[model samples]
Target: MISKDKPAALILIDIQKGFDNIEYWGGERNNPNAEENASAILKLWRENEFPIFHIQHCSSNPNSLLNENNEGNEFKEEVKPLAGEIVIKKNVNSAFIGTDLKQQLDAAKIETLVILGLTTDHCVSTTTRMAGNYGYETFLVSDATATFNKKGVDGQDFSAQLIHETALASLNGEFATVITTDFLKQNLL
Candidate 1:
């Protein structure tokens, strides 16, 4: 368990409608209740008056489901940012790159981060790695993030669960302390 004494910020990354397009995203995904889990964490953060940051991914590729002009680019209803909450928009995977997310967190004197969102192997993983490298005590909510199937370099297919677990395994201990939303609620809430 992490120390609860330090100030913590909730970082929500790319929880958008684009992820709903399973076909566009390549195949079936893991964690059907990911949005609900994320919403639960968001509500806890809001209720406790913790700092919150919403990261929106605006893909540069026109064919991408996350393209700015596409309806799928819109944020999911569960994790939508309200007034006074910071929303960081980026075209890349890492939220820290090409964005003021680090500066904002630094300015707020955040010592820890509670992160969750769509595509666990992408934006969430990147941001968690960067956050760890930047010296923040980061906690990744495992069940709150989901990812779809993918093809490996050798044309081997990977299941969504495999990718998700692999990503979390890579991040655990090295990038962030991986925990479930239920654990967070039990301990922090």
Candidate 2:
């Protein structure tokens, strides 16, 4: 439902090296190509001169994988932004919680956001829900997002991939619309 009449922004979040580990997903999500997928979306946004925002997570503990000093905290090379792109750092799951994301969006007159990034069920989901609550039309690039597997509350081996799919399904036509890279590439003006 995103059209050229409504200004759209691309939000890329936390496609970091920490997501590349096998243990994070109980070995079920070994080869996630989120970076490549995100990169293609980024290219389209850049070519069209649409607003693009990059988000990075900062962990509170020095020992954490997303610690500011860790190379894993940096965005993967494939989706890394070019010079002059807006980059926002956050300490929570929602990028706008303590960041200037909302103000930036307002300044740019962006009413819609096309989101793609790492950990689909975490930061991506959090931001999508928040954006919806804040009245922004949001779309999630399903295949361009991923997540790591951790223990569920029931203590079972949760599948990160499955959880990601569930999150995508849950958001469709509610919090956000879930679309594919091909759909975006074809529909972007």
Runs with alpha carbons beyond 4 Å of true place in candidate 1? 1-5
Error of 2 at 186 (Å): 1.7
Local distance difference test, candidate 2: 0.83
Candidate 1 on 1-189: residue-level lDDT in tens? 333456489999999998998987877899999999999888877877888899999999998888999988999998889999999999999999999999999998887999999889999999999999999999999999999999999999999999999999999999899999988978855
Which pairs of residues collide in candidate 2? 120-146
lDDT of 1: 0.91
Instruction: Report model 1's TM-score to 2 decimal places.
Output: 0.96
Q: Give per-residue lDDT, candidate 2, residue 151.
A: 80
Candidate 2 matches the true fold with a TM-score of 0.92
